[model samples]
Target: MSTVKEAVDVEVPLHTAYNQWTQFEDFPNFMEGVEEVRQLDDRHNHWTTSIGGVRREFDTEIVDQLPDDRITWRTTDGDTRQRGTVRFESLDDAHTRVELTMDVEPSGLVEKGADALGMIDRRVKGDLRRFKEFIERRGTESGAWRGRVRPGDPGGGLI
Candidate 1:
């Protein structure tokens, strides 16, 4: 397994940053390799992405979530094996720091090679930088889901 961590500070309130992140389907707007994301439900999402010339489709389930704080997810099915968390921290009323940590298991030679070259880290850093620009330009979230998901809650507490 390989891990990549990246962070960026956005010029928005904690809630604004957090809320925008909750709109998973909007990820493609800022995420480089993500082609599309479909929110199956509050806690489930289907993703299509092309990285390193490889296209993959995956399903991910949110495992834990706390409004305006953090969200954690794991890939449930697909060609990818990974888990990650995105956390939001308030720097002040007008600034929020968003941090992302991801653990990925390379299943084949291509993925392993990409990992060895620090491609994942660069991709993550670029994504975060784009996210900062995206949210800052918008100045508000398109939508938000404030529901809390506890550790043992089914479906990550969609309700």
Candidate 2:
């Protein structure tokens, strides 16, 4: 597995940044190579992505979440293997910082080569930069779900 970590500061309030991120189905709006993300439930999602001509479909389950703080998820079934976390930090009332970290498993020769060449790292950084631009331009979140999902919560978001 290889890890990628990146962060960006957005010109938006913490809640605004956090809220926008909760809208998983909207990821394609900012994420490069992401074709679609379907929210299966409060804690599960299906993702379709094509990167460097490689297409993949995957399902992920949120393992932990805290409003305005962090969200963590891992792929459950898919051609891609990954686990990731995104954290939101309030820089001020009008500014926020978002951090993303991921551990990914390369599936085949092409993917492994890309990873070795730092393509995956750069891709993740670009995604965060796009997300920063997206939220800063909108100035408001499309929607939000502030429900909490604690460790061992089974990702139901009942809290």
Candidate 3:
């Protein structure tokens, strides 16, 4: 597995940032490679993405979440496995910093090679940048879900 981490600051409140992120189905609006995200439930989702002519689908389970704070998830069964988390840091009442970290298992040598060449990193960073723009421009969350999990809690948000 390889790990990638990135962050961006947004001109939005922590709750705004966290709440917008909870609206998983809205990812494709900002995530360049995300073709779709269907929230199966509060804690589970089906994801479709295409990057560099490679298309892939996966399901993810939210393992942990905290209101206006953090969310973490992992792929359940798929051609590739990944675990990731997003953390919301309140810079002030009207500004927040969002951080994303991921650990992924490449499907094979070709996938691994692409990742090692920094393509995946660029995509991740680009996605975050788009997210920043999306949220900043909207100035409000697409929607919010009062999840069952709390920031330090586990096995609650992702079904």
Q: TM-score for candidate 1, please give it.
A: 0.96
Best by lDDT: 1
What TM-score do all the candidates reach, one by one? 0.96, 0.96, 0.91
**Candidate 1's residue-wise lDDT over 1-159, tens digit each?**
899999999999999999999999999999998999999998899999988788999999999999999999999889899998999999999999999999999878998998999988998999999999999999999999999877668665221
Q: Give one digit per residue, the lDDT tens place, for model 3 in 81-126.
A: 9999999999989999999999988887778888889877887899
Residue-level lDDT tens digits of model 2 in 1-159: 999999999999999999999999999999999999999888899999998899999998898999999999888888999988999999999999999999999999999999999999999999999999999889999999999888677543311
Task: List the global CA lDDT of all models.
Answer: 0.92, 0.92, 0.86
The lDDT of model 2 is 0.92
Model 3's alpha-carbon lDDT is 0.86
Clashing pairs in 1: none
Model 3: ten consecutive residues of lowest lDDT: 150-159
What is the TM-score of candidate 2?
0.96
Model 2, residue 104: distance off in Å is 0.6
Clashing residue pairs in all predictions, respectively, total 0, 0, 5
